[model samples]
Target: MDSGELEHPPAEELQVGPILLALADDNRRRVVAELYERSDGERLCASFDLPVSKSSRTRHWRVLREAGLVHQRSIGNGLYMRLRKDDLESRFPGLIQAVVGAP
Candidate 1:
């Protein structure tokens, strides 16, 4: 793995507990919701207009990455992220839609 890349669990290793915990945060969920709407491509971490402090945003990203909900890679001076939608769907069918589409 590249040194600039963050560690992410294998798709089959995605557990419900971690995923639920990560999504429990409104900020993280908001990120996921926005990611859900995007096509399959990485977006810069700064692109999300999250209403949180830089430290908090970092924490949210860590949680999401650690939970295997997203994959993050550092490129140049920016961090890029992409939702692990396909992985999540494969591990827990319909979970992404259920979470992002929830009322």
Candidate 2:
């Protein structure tokens, strides 16, 4: 990994199959939306007052990260997440926007 790039589970190494399975839910979508609202350089911590079990919330986040939809960084005991906007946009143009704009 580059010095500036924090060590992360390689998006390539992650099991995309499991990630896809986990993301096929409404709750996961909400989690993504919540993260999307944050400004660049900001991260969404798991403990940020969501109405869900901690275990379930963790699973949701793992799905996003493993699927290459988001990037996760470990800071102390907390895991912070940010959407992989540019990467995903390049892979699937307008996919992020379509999902975010979905009602």
Candidate 3:
């Protein structure tokens, strides 16, 4: 193995497969687009105008979080979610650009 591989956590290497799976869903793709293209910064779960119900929205966020596409932090009764831009950029170059830049 290359010495550079040692610098990344094993979990980091595992993110792509899950991220791809998460993006495969239409709702999850929309979620990513909203966060990546619309939101100015970290946003509450309730802020997104997703088509899904609240409970379903939570599940979607969980998928994104598990995929390492979003960073979720609990704040009181609400959860704040932000796109893992740096991680995604480093792991998959041009992906965010393609998704966000899509017309």
lDDT of 2 by residue, 1-103 (tens): 6543444455445554554564567787666666667778247465566678888777667666667777877676766778776666665567656676788
Residue-wise C-alpha lDDT for candidate 3, range 1-103, written one tens digit per residue: 5532212223356456777888888888877887886546478878888787889997898788777888777667777888878788888888866876665
8-78 per-residue lDDT for model 1 (tens digits): 99898889999999999999998999988988746899989988899999999999999999999888899
Tell me how many residue pairs clash in candidate 1. Answer: 0
Candidate 3 Cα RMSD (Å): 7.4
Q: What global local distance difference test value does model 2 have?
A: 0.65
Which sequence of candidate numbers ranks them by lDDT, best first? 1, 3, 2
What lDDT is obtained when candidate 1 is compared to the true structure?
Answer: 0.90
**Location of the lowest summed lDDT over 10 successive residues in candidate 1:** 1-10
Query: Which runs in model 1 stand beyond 4 Å of their true positions?
Result: none
Stretch of 10 with least lDDT, candidate 2: 3-12
Error of 1 at 71 (Å): 0.3
The true-versus-predicted C-alpha distance at residue 69 of model 1, in Å, is 0.3
Tell me how far candidate 1 lies from the true structure as C-alpha RMSD in angstroms. Answer: 1.2
Top candidate on lDDT is 1
For all the candidates, what are their Cα RMSDs to the real structure? 1.2, 4.2, 7.4
